[model samples]
Target: MSNTKDIPFSPPWQISDLGKPDEPKVTELAAGPAVARFAKMPIVIAEDDLVSRTLMNSLMEKWGFKAVVTKDGHEAMAALRAEQGPALTILDWMMPEMDGLQVCRRIRESGKMVYVIMLTSLGAKENIVEGLHAGADDYLIKPFDKNELLARIQVGLRILELHAALSARVKELEKAVGQIDDLKLRIPL
Candidate 1:
């Protein structure tokens, strides 16, 4: 007999009738304070599978993220290109119109600092290498563990934060250089 207290409480719809006995349950992925820190941060999800997309959206909401869900690569690209679009994106490998690799390439070519996470069933060594070369910041195979996914997302968030800080520092340094140049102009040589 299974211990009812050991199982996490999930909505009936979320619990698959044919789910494996050993399948891990989805628990609270983020701590309360951590969730508050990233609450309402938009994240784009590009997934062709309805079930997978729904699950991702649910998880994002539960973790206090604002999920901009898309069903195709084209839609994903559009969302990412929009003004004030999310810096973090989760993309599936194969989709109609444009594949995730193509999307990643486009994002890189456009010179945007978007962090892309390729979530797919392509787990081969070559596939992982190819995905990374295509400019994906991270790659995750499908049927992923919820905790692992959250950890990966947190990593992306930290990287993005660092990028933002570095960019700001660069701008400050440039302004200081400009000020020094002005001072040099005012001073006699």
Candidate 2:
């Protein structure tokens, strides 16, 4: 039997597995998303509930994404600051010390463009709008399905790719404009 233990970390659904004797473990950093496949963009997971956190991390690996897992908003913020690359984030709506909304707002103010997805059990329309206004790109309800979450992540990946392309194009245009200006300066009036 797979030995996963329950922990009494606040918010109830917390779990921790000691180890499965015959299984190989997945680490916090994986090559799937951060290597040749997902453009080296790490996905940040900030969930308070241990069970949910563990499940999300597992799914991320299976979905071919590298993850930086954080216990709460504070840790998530630290991870965001330290990641130093384009990254997508999954934030839990309710967490101790700092909630997801607070984290989302701070991320928006940082001026770094990252796709944020709010993971919550709250399915109300107003709640979703609140999350969006806080700067979340999308929202996923709890007990999420494997395939659906993967598809949603795929959408985020696509958007991130598009953003990167646009940024590159802008740089090229700026360089060309600079060259043109230099040539104009050399022309006789």
Candidate 3:
């Protein structure tokens, strides 16, 4: 006969002695698009929601890219200004203190060619147009899937690359003109 009070306790880590089923560990989803994997640059994500911010950050990391997350447009601006080297920004359309549209215009006015993608809950055509006019390279609506966001980001990166190429060509042309002016001075003009 066994005493009821004398039962030995089993360690929880003893897998064979377990009674209840173990709960499944949660795993974060990866970015759905392959383009995300090609990004080797740093990107800033400005989103107020904690869940969205974490999801975006994890996706960026999984894609082998560096990411900084901010709660509002103002913080995003500060990060952009302080960061060295190349960086891209993803701004939420509506935020406290400063909005995405305002941030985009401000960044454009600074004359720095940082790629910007605006994320918004406003999916209307007019709203998207407005965002475009505000200097956003691309627009994404809320509840967007990972693949859609990644694709839009690729578009912004391509546009930025083109802009950089054009700007370099213009600079080269300007330098040639300056050299020609020097040659003209040597000709006694």
Winning model by TM-score: 1
Where's the lowest-lDDT run of ten residues in candidate 2? 7-16
Task: Score candidate 2 by lDDT.
Answer: 0.75
Off by over 4 Å in 1: 1-27, 32-35, 83-86
Q: What is the lDDT of residue 131 in candidate 3?
A: 99
User: Which structure is stronger by lDDT: 1 or 2?
Assistant: 1
User: Compared with the true structure, what per-residue lDDT tens digits does model 3 show for residues 1-189?
Assistant: 865332222211232322222321112334333233324456888888888889889877765556888999888989888765445899998888889999999999988778888888999999999999999988888878877776676676666555655666677779999999999999985
Q: Work out the TM-score per prediction.
A: 0.82, 0.79, 0.74
In lDDT terms, how accurate is model 1?
0.78
**What lDDT score belongs to each candidate, Candidate 1 first?**
0.78, 0.75, 0.72
**TM-score-based ranking:** 1, 2, 3
Residue-wise lDDT of candidate 2 within 7-29, one digit each (tens)? 22221111123133233232432
